[model samples]
Target: VAGQFGKSAVAAAPTLLTKELTFNFQQKRSIQLAMVELEDMPVRSEAEELVFSLLIAILPERLPEQTQLLSNYPNPFNPETWIPFELSQDSKVSVTIYNVAGTPVRNISVGYLQAGSYVSQLKSVYWDGKSDTGERVSSGTYFYQIRAGDYTETRKMVILK
Candidate 1:
């Protein structure tokens, strides 16, 4: 009788004590059903524990690695230069040239490479002083950056016409 009156009043007082009791009762019923089936699958927890133990035992034996790029050549070049770098891991690499004002002028590399040292020639790219679209670039300082994996490095060069 009381449960029926409480259920009818729930349409108006949605958060009455009876509604709270009903929600908790359903949750307890579901938990009881789940526990009734747990005895057949105890190995899941054991396997998870074993994997975690192995990872803890082996992870400390590894070392951190680093990647680097040696400074470029012909630092103050007229029409040509060279940029070199080394990668510690196989990575997607990009080398970009930018003017003193930080605008990208040329893309020297936009490709993937294996781990090793490499050199790139900047022949058609050097300042006869010209831009990528072949407009005459002014004599000024320019910068280039090499990006390999998670590493990045920048260096400056000069253009003299």
Candidate 2:
């Protein structure tokens, strides 16, 4: 039976299935196993009666585009929230938090980053709803701006005390 399929045929069968399969991970900083269903296959020979299970390690997808300043998560947060961003290439990055009155509260300098996508959980860059002086800021709407090379963007976030 194995001779009919050949060793390479059995070994490479899983690779062919993955070509039509897409993986999606819902959580950050976590590993999960998900079963995917493939299209129905027709049994051609007795050798094909052998069943095989394939396991593929999935990773987060990447967005290879221009620099982007993504929004902070858990908005209307009490103390802290995550900030995520993406860099298409290596560049100096800076993130600043400002109050509604247009005053800079905290400045986070990322310095230099390579070209890739970055998430707060992976990068550990978060805002603790505090000013640079280590004092907690009032609850309200705030803005965060990212300056990376010549690519700049501003986004709004909410803090709920």
Q: What total of clashing residue pairs does each candidate reach?
A: 1, 0
The Cα error of candidate 2 at residue 147, in Å, is 0.9
Every candidate's lDDT? 0.59, 0.70
Candidate 2: global Cα-lDDT? 0.70
Candidate topping lDDT = 2
lDDT (tens digit, per residue) of candidate 1 on 1-161: 86465433433343343334332434543433343334335565754544433332322122113567666677677766677766656778887889888998887655787554464563212224456787766678988888888888988888776
Best by TM-score: 2
Scored by Cα lDDT, where does model 1 land? 0.59
**Residue pairs whose backbone atoms clash in candidate 2:** none
